[model samples]
Target: MMLPLILLYLIGYETRVTTACSRLEACNSEFRTGLEVAGIQEPESSAPYCAELRAYSQCIKKANKACRGDLSFHTSTAVIDSLMKRFKCAQQNWGPPYKRPSVKPKSNSICSHQSNSEYVHCGIFGDPHLKTFTKSYQTCGAKGAWPLIDNKFLAIQVTNMPVINSSSATATTKVTIIIRRVPGCAEEKTFEATSDAPLRPFFVDSSYSTGPEGSVQMKASINKTEKVEIYLRYIDTTLVVRRVGEYLGFSCRLPWDIAKIREENALELCQTGCPGTELLDIASSRGHRLSWETALNKCKQDMDLETGVRNNLTDQYLDWCVFDVMTTGKNEFVSTAHLAQEDVLYMDPSSLRNRTFPLDLNGIPKPSSAAISNVTLNLQVTAVVDRCGRNVVHAPAYEGAPQVGRVAIKVPPIWENRIPVL
Candidate 1:
């Protein structure tokens, strides 16, 4: 669970040291935000970022006087002491003339925007199907935490959990996105979302964005579960991370130039899509006894009702809805499918209907609603068999794209069972 944000310091004039220390906790958080402002996402290697460390040390040292009383005071000091020691801040000069190190921008920088950026789209949804920025598509049993997007300006990660207790099949349950500080635009931001505690519109710092970058202001909040959108003004990007069923889903619209195939992003899931894995066709999974007619009709109806944009944005989502319904025996996926389509439309208003994606359906499926009946769901766990003859291994994942892995990882692709679930 995330700590409740404490931005306001409510220290009273009472003489009780405990009260002062309690308030000092707020100062501690405020002091740490300096790191965020410095564009340091990972605090583990914050040693070289000596400026922030010194600020924090000074704050703690000042608190040493009034914040003395209980074990909390001692404990807090111990933690801060350990952090400073670990970073070896004592050896470094926090004095004048001590220049701070530079943080190299990530390989995929966001300073450039091309004309085709409006049509560049990528997403991750049910069954962990991924659509890369290049319009490539693949369904992966990537059953652990994986980076959907990692660039100099932004990073998105998803954690997949088993759908059923004993099944190897998994879905995303958590999503975390990091927005690094832009030189003159937005400050660094962090956001977290889980199935139970979906994301809100604001960042962990309780701020939407650092005063809007020019005429276009950055957007930080959107509805949860249904569809969550965050507009990054600095990068000119829109990120959609949502919750569906027992998991989470992510989507993004980037400028084509920013999505160029680079050495570092060759293996990014959102950049290169998932590797070829013969996924168990959920629609044909045995024992599931699922009825796709209802979902097909539902998603199709929603798409048909939309008059604003005459695009086939719902094509992939329609397929995803049917697949999720067949896999989980639930029809809510129909709404999620509709939501994804609408989100894509809102995220990018370009003529996407004319744009071609690798996994685009020729047209929306036409399902007859004449015989709408209650879908029968039989959630029987089935064996997972790799449809392909290839041996399964814990394939390493990349940060920028799923092709070239730069981040160290221990996640293993454990879904050896290509078994279908009801």
Candidate 2:
């Protein structure tokens, strides 16, 4: 999938941040608890954001220093103030105020009074510059440069959470979470989704509720990375609260080379190493040039170290050499009995005429035999892009090194009885 241009911004961020975990104990606790609330572990042991946070924090620190260190503090605070102005408090009145009967009580303001049943806290965080945070004037419609967020880990808590579905046996509240200090546009980007449904407009209390319910306090710190932490709370009884959570760990950027390494590892694990020496040599020689070669070689190397796995590399350049000889009977120097086997063997008259034959009882007869004059070996090779897929070459022409004449035989004529079959 084509991820948004935000990926580019993350690449830059990765270099600047160093230590994302300002407090080891606190970060670990948050991670453990968050995982418990999430119910499942993060993918590939990447849960809790401890590792990513550390890296992001260090990167941000570096970037901050380069941007003038303490010089930018006042500016950042100004930016934060501007951004926070968007969120306005909604009004609410729990009950009538207690009063001594001495003096007349004053009426409550609209910010404090509300009838029951209406969602009292419904309010919008407004900013004319909100959308501009993620975009630049140069790139219209394209998500512009992503700004660096303060690496602070802020603890967020939502308690007395609102009930989105008082009727349903199980219902989730949804809240729209906009990343604070995000640059350019506020084009909504979701973290990880539980199912196929997009999680955004994210929920604060429930997965669907719009407002912050109850007192949910999440511990956050400065210089920490941003990861999606979803806390699910349930009540076995009203007094006892239980939580399960699922979190998505986001790296400032995608680990492209790391992914390639994983693929290589998996391939080696699956195939028990590659098929041939030629392929191994080619991979070793050219691995630096292509991701495919590097990945294949790394996998082969790992598989070689693993027990019960043998290197039989065949999909590499060396395999091309091995298979070429096996198919054409041109390179008689290679041992074929153990490497390449076929139900049948075909030979071209020209090849059979001049080639030195291996003196096996099962191999082709010597060139001096009477039958050699009428003998013709029909060899064919097919090109295919994938295993289990149709052959790409119906009747491919065989090309040898310049010193050797290339051979191309038309399909029907090569197979016909009139072509002087061997």
- Clash number for model 2? 78
Error of 2 at 304 (Å): 16
| Range of the 10 consecutive residues with the lowest summed lDDT in candidate 1 | 1-10
Tens-digit per-residue lDDT, 1-422, candidate 2? 11111121221211111123223223223333433444433322222223333332333344453443332232333322332222210122212222112221124422122221101000100000010111100001111112111111111111111111221111111222232221221122222223113333233323321112321212221112122332211100000011112111111111112111222223210011111220111111211122333333333331222221222322211233232222222221021111111000010011112111111112222332222122212111222222433222222122211112333333332223322111
> Mind giving the per-residue lDDT tens digits that candidate 1 earns over 30-127?
45455556666444434445556566555656677777764445544555555566567677765642223333323444442323232467777766
Model 1 deviation from native, Cα RMSD in Å: 22.6
Candidate 1's C-alpha runs over 4 A off are: 1-118, 165-168, 211-226, 261-266, 277-289, 294-314, 347-422
- Model 2: lDDT of residue 205: 29
Best by TM-score: 1
Q: Considering summed lDDT, which 10 consecutive residues are worst modelled in model 2?
A: 120-129
